[model samples]
Target: MNEDAQAALGILAQQIRMAGNNPDQPNRVGNANPALSSLRNPVYGTTSLTLAGTNTTSQLSMRGCDGTFTNINSTNTTTTGIDALTCVAGGTNTVPDSIAVSYEADRFNTIPTGGTSSLPTDCLGNKLPVVTATVSTIVAGTASSADVTYTVADNRYYIGTASVANVVTPSLYCKGNGGASVQMPMVENIETLQLRYGTVSTASTATTATVAGYLHATEVLTETSMALLANDAERWAKVATVRICVLVRSENPVAPNAASAQYTDCAGNLVDNPPDLRLRRAYTTTVVLRNRRL
Candidate 1:
């Protein structure tokens, strides 16, 4: 090759080495994926996914372990670190589940609606918390009225039946706050929902007013217990992201023919059928809590 071309190649090689092999920007150090070392540059862009259909494009991006990003859509998502004990069976070896709940048309009726409604029971069902220490399946059928409540706090988990309950389950989880009501257990509130990052593995309510660190309202993981993981970062090294999703239902499910269907208020009125529930376009990301020397 000519000297000019050779020089250009040499310069590019140096840049790659200095910036790391990845086309993406610098990662949050500890969270950088060595496997993705060559693929860098994560930004908002639309690619012609289709051959000749329409010059359409979709938004794509990546996030650091200790970072957060928002998508083209207005959904707000968070990615942070949680305790290791909250992971599923695979623990750090796998991608933790993700749950995204968006405001959809009320399930109680057709067309747009108003007011909050209860979620569908057995939707994803209630999964158990991380009891095995190696991550376990979120126990389904874990939400019982006698064992849970939402009247006081956002993330509260009680035990037994609402009518004749007493002792609370140590592993129960609950921290929910929609616009109107908080759906506990397995209530499918709206028309449709989406799952991103992973799945809707578990959802538990808190018993009293407790500050959930890495836990999301829809699912539970070890990272949710931030202080616990912070104290034992070595044990909780598998977690990469802690995301939060909110499934807000309108106060009342309105009929499709409602005159105020087109209204757009805090209660979120709509004129047509809402789209399926997708992961919030935004999220807060955190790194795997590990002791770093000062």
Candidate 2:
């Protein structure tokens, strides 16, 4: 392939990677993409450790959602210990084993009660609106009532500091200086993009959550719909995954052929007789929210 063609393919790859692998910030509650809004909450799961065998003197460790482990020493009985058996420190004693350790999603960081006087901004200086009922808690596990400070935004897997934004409303087509209509490329060669959301219903009992169905971005992108989604904790809690699809084309045109090629779009619609000679391809990816799963 020529350098230009290689460069075009590289751009397409980069865009797909960005949309697929970019993990949501722990604090970011939902998808902020202007063109496509979907669930972006991190999945909530549990990490447990059991204290068994003849090892009373061994210190027990607790791993947080952020992957950091904290040593639970015998002295930390009142705070981190579970029952009468204290997590011992620096000794080797046998029997009287405490063989049970449970992790429940009891801690949450929410927007301060009664709203904040000042606006909140992320680390990237992007302004954040006052989010009501923006609670980040663990689901599926037994909950603890105690409010503990936990890590929310682990910058490790995050892509851009600011939320993804696009100017979809404004048309890029405008009149040129020569009084001729021309298309100005705001984002080069990206033709279409679509997003689908998968939501689960709140479990009535301790059973596993089930995904209701996939909905297009337009179905849930309205103001009223967004409000309903935000206020309904059960609905928000049910968001399990998001599917992203991006369609891109080469800047240069290919050899024109009499027969047209058919392509399958993101919505599973067949596009017959696609008349463009520019080499085009669609990329798709699915992201699961670990914190939302059981």
Candidate 3:
């Protein structure tokens, strides 16, 4: 092969390797599989909140995605009755088990209900402070001093934080007709980036979860929506495996005169080549959440 042609092939190989073998950590550390390592830990928070009835107003202060505490109100609502727990004039109380509430990290801050000296205490007796609440709903009970388990919705933690590193986005290089060869800032290249979720119904009975089929990121919409998908806990807890595919193309025309090729892209879309010399390829990998599985 000519020197130019050989060099072009080398470049294509390098790009593919970079896409497949790039460090999954946001800081670009270690040789972890980008497919699985990127999604190592799903962002979520779980805490318990005790309710107080006398005030007809209660708050649960929970940590946000950014590690800040946000207040969640457990105010008595007309629709959801709060008669399960008895609020004594002066006595300790716990939140009822029936009142299940899940919180979203983003929608945490609602109007400030002011500070409460009578805030709910966790199992360890640590007094949790009240901050603010954007969204709060009392699902079942109306007890004055009942214990409520507050789960901050599960979110994609692969995006990384200021201190921690994670890998969720993949990037690639490509050249358009008139534009110089450039790297697409986002999960780039020729076609779609597809993901499939594997969910298990029973953790003990089954060894592997059932594949729920491919889906777009928008399907889950928000962390709250994700919590409600399929079974309440399936979205994150039962997510055993994730399949990722990236369909990409060469930045330069390596296969000139190659007849208009027909191919299937990542999102399972068929495409007819644009009669260009660019070479295209698809890379796929399956990532299992070992922690979730165990």
RMSD of each: 26.3, 22.8, 20.6
For model 1, what is the error of residue 202's alpha carbon versus the real structure, in angstroms, after optimal superposition? 24
TM-score pick, better of 2 and 3: 2
How far does residue 73 in candidate 1 sit from its true spot (Å)? 36
- Sort by TM-score, best first: what order? 2, 3, 1
Sliding window of 10 residues with minimal summed lDDT for model 3: 91-100
Which regions of candidate 1 are displaced past 4 Å?
1-236, 255-294
Positional deviation of residue 177's Cα in model 2 after best superposition, in angstroms: 34
For model 2, the stretches where C-alpha displacement exceeds 4 angstroms are 1-188, 204-207, 218-234, 273-275
TM-score, every prediction: 0.18, 0.35, 0.34
lDDT winner, 1 or 2: 2
Task: Count clashing pairs, candidate 2.
Answer: 7
**Candidates ranked, most accurate by lDDT first:** 2, 3, 1
Query: lDDT, candidate 2, residue 226?
Result: 41
